[model samples]
Target: MSVVPRVANDSDPDISHVRDRGALRLIACGSVDDGKSTLIGRLLHEAQGVLDDQLAAITRESRRFGTTGEDVDFALLLDGLEAERQQGITIDVAYRFFSTARRAFVVADTPGHAQYTRNMATGASTSELAILLVDARKGLLEQTRRHAAIVALLGIRDVVLAVNKMDLVGWSPERFGEVTAAFRAFAGPLAFRSVIAIPLSARFGDNVAAASPSTPWYGGPTLLDHLETVADEIDIGRGEVLAPPRARPTVTRRFAADLVWMTDHDGLAGGRFLLKTGTTTVPAVITTIADRLDLGTLGRVPADRLGLNAIGRVHVETAVPVAIDSYAENRSTGAFILIDRTTHATAAAGLVIAWLDAARDVHAEASAVAPATRAFVKSQEPLVVWLTGLPGAGKSTIANLVEQRLVKLGHHTMLLDGDNVRQGLNADLGFDVASRAENVRRVAEVARLMTEAGLIVLVALVSPLRADRERAAGLFPPERFMEVLVEASPATCRTRDPKGLYAKAEAGRIANFTGRDQPYEPPLAPALVLPTDEIGPEIAAERLIQAILGRIRQPTASDDASI
Candidate 1:
């Protein structure tokens, strides 16, 4: 494949227009089959970014898929990967780049399915605007509202609601007005600073690149026009910028006497100074130095002996008495966080609190654990058994059985069931993609803690989606994480109806419920696949135990194995 280089010509007015213009990173979000890909492809094709070879490829795919109409199947252009082409649904955020006469654009096409909302967040987190697509025929659906709410939460300031499929709806002005009004009413209170609504048909090229004659009643500019004009500036001063540095006291008597030098100019020549600690950047000076009184031997040395990465005690005079302890004291309150002034990204994690000599000794004594004794008496291994399946699949049952077998083997274990966690630890969480991700995040964190404490952790969650499972897997080492896919047909799960959730979802009591209203993306690959419909819980547990034992028996010398 040949790489396309970015070209700019000073003589060309279009190129010159964008010479110094800032880049805009935008996310396109909507329900499945809402023509997000087509709209983006239209924008790219009209802007002359789509190469002849790539356009030919898209045409070939379109013909193969039986889209014989003169208008190209623009969706084929973005469904580039083989898996995405076959699936007919975007499971991941597809990034595409294109430039206009006024500005450059980096577009993130995110999945509209509720199951992949987390993926949408990953795209929108860094976006300046969210282009939310609304199918003109379907109006504003549940997923549309969900995406809007997510865009607001991610701090995106600009939103463009492209009401697409106008050709299918005969480009009705009243329909466009109604849908646009409903969406604006729902999104008005969100964090977005501006919202622009446009009527367009991504497939028919209406209101995308050029003003569509079909929608003569519509007065606003096309989608591309809005994108080209939307301001790309962002305010990043909402959060704290810098954190305080950690401080520690010196144990040497000479350093104690150097306290005077902390504020005095004559005591030390090249000692390091910090303007602020934590949020307070108060100016301080070394004032007093007290010599070591307990030293049995007498020695004279300059205070310059304080070397690189060395800790020392010095009395400091500040413009004000800043409340700060040695970094060795408290890791949280004493810690300082650093942010990059340019990109606004967190650059470094810092510790601010420090401890004095006597306090350091006491802290060391209190916090130190007898590792050798603990290892000898009750050494334990930590592992996470991640169970994933459809909603009513028998994950919890198998998890219970596995816990019993591990307990019988004299291993410390804990079960983190989805329902139990939803009631307690993840009570504040919802069923949306963001909430689901947060739920999994909490579970993964708890599992990590349990593993560190030398306990086996079993997580019985429907998990449903592969991205969530992958995020959980990333939290632990490969050897420590066992992804067990409890396979059962969606039909079987609805039939099982262990908790009547499926019934409630089918009755419309719940909106965007997985397996009914939302999609359940299965695990692409898993360490184990237990046929929940075919096997009993006991047999499943036995199989899992055997697999665990086999893994343990493998020639791995240590548990902290890196993958």
Candidate 2:
């Protein structure tokens, strides 16, 4: 047995040449048994990319599993998984690589099943060209149309129609032409850049690598030949790359009549301008040039510093001037989305229009202290503690204790008990899945508002589902939302029976009660879990407080003594 030496990039000069030229990534897609896997395996084998040992292994595996008197099933080469071998279907997108003398190809053999359309989409999303296969005898099927539609939707510009199983149909030119015309008619209105059709029998390797004598009437280039010669298309709408840079101007406006403007080269140093009109984006260098100038018409400015939402025109002098527009002209194309430097999440959506003058007027009229001053006076950071557990699991008890401790510390605190809130705020909500989700959503919104108002909010709810908990978590800042799961066994909760709700569920009076009929998916990674079997309510409350504050390094002797 001989081994084909692995081709090394450093040793092969042609490999480097192709790398410089760039690789062609093609995704092969078709309905089941259109020979997608077989086509790819044959391409790999005929191109001498497959090693002898691997081929022998595939051959041995084929003989052991091949039905009755079947020839070497080349599909077996790519269908390596046990599940796929048993089912004889490709369940996922299988990637294979092979190269020819001119170019290297990365092939994605996508699954054809309707259920695996998402996987097909995954394969097609990055593909520059989609090789759509069809059985010559079958003509065109619904699945083929579906695959073509998805290819167009995912923005694949180039398409190669591989009409497989020509050998099964006796290499009929008329049959191939009929299928090709039908496909073209179906795909004519689609957004593909180009559609090239070829007739090939992947099983017998006809018209695949080299021109097959099987089709003398067909005069088109071979599949590989067409792939190697096709010109790489470019998107023309992307504007000129080497155009002379425009001079970006920074304008500064005063609350009075005078407006000062500067250019990138020599513009007025940092001043604020009310965006009068036009969509524009000035360079960040303007921030260095101006100090502070106020403009009229905008509403009360809230912050002392010019952060996001503080937009002003300042004079700037770049080496040149660039045409820019005000953010109000176009929101999507003109405005910029600002993200937090640390978290990378969108912190604020900014528009260039500014109302600095109006902001100063509003600030002059308002006599109340600012929110920052109020927060400072409170001497506590506002946060929301969400307690989730089964009913009768002592959530309310723990929440009450925790709130009392915070109250004693002179912190403004509010407890939104699940049962109490249901009476007033969530009165109209029901126990169905959608209703339950809505109820939790309303509570989370109210809690968020309370936290933002500089009040500590403790919510005690039997939020049985994990999805509901995650939704609540997303509404608040990461540092503000704390999830505390009150862990108690179903038997323990039933024995406690604080509300007799468990008894009602068992007696068939109530339906879909958590831990009785409906499921309670426990939190996978809660901030704190209080086990009622071991820790008393007092200790649990202290633990919850310590988790939230992080300043209480060691539990005081009095704290433990009280528990």
How many pairs of residues collide in each model? 35, 45
lDDT of 2 at 332: 20
The window of 10 residues in a row where model 2 has the poorest summed lDDT is 2-11
Poorly placed runs, candidate 2 (over 4 Å): 1-21, 41-94, 98-104, 110-122, 140-157, 181-194, 203-206, 209-221, 229-377, 420-429, 445-454, 474-481, 487-511, 524-563
List the global CA lDDT of all models.
0.64, 0.64
lDDT of 2 by residue, 1-563 (tens): 21111101111232224344466667888787788888888788878878999888877877776431456667777787788888888887777667778877667788877656545755664456888999999987766776786566445678999999999888998999999999988887775788999999887777778899999988887787877776553211112122222322222211211112211122223221222112222222222222322223122333223432223233222111222224333222222322232344333222334322332223223425543344445655678889999898899999999989988877788999999988998999878555566677779878877765668899999888775677678666777788889999999999999889988988999987889787887898988899987889999999998886772222233422222
TM-score of 2: 0.57
**What TM-score do all the candidates reach, one by one?**
0.42, 0.57
**Candidate 1: where are CA atoms >4 Å away?**
1-21, 66-70, 234-563
True-structure lDDT of candidate 2: 0.64
- Candidate 1 — what's its lDDT? 0.64
RMSD of 2: 19.6
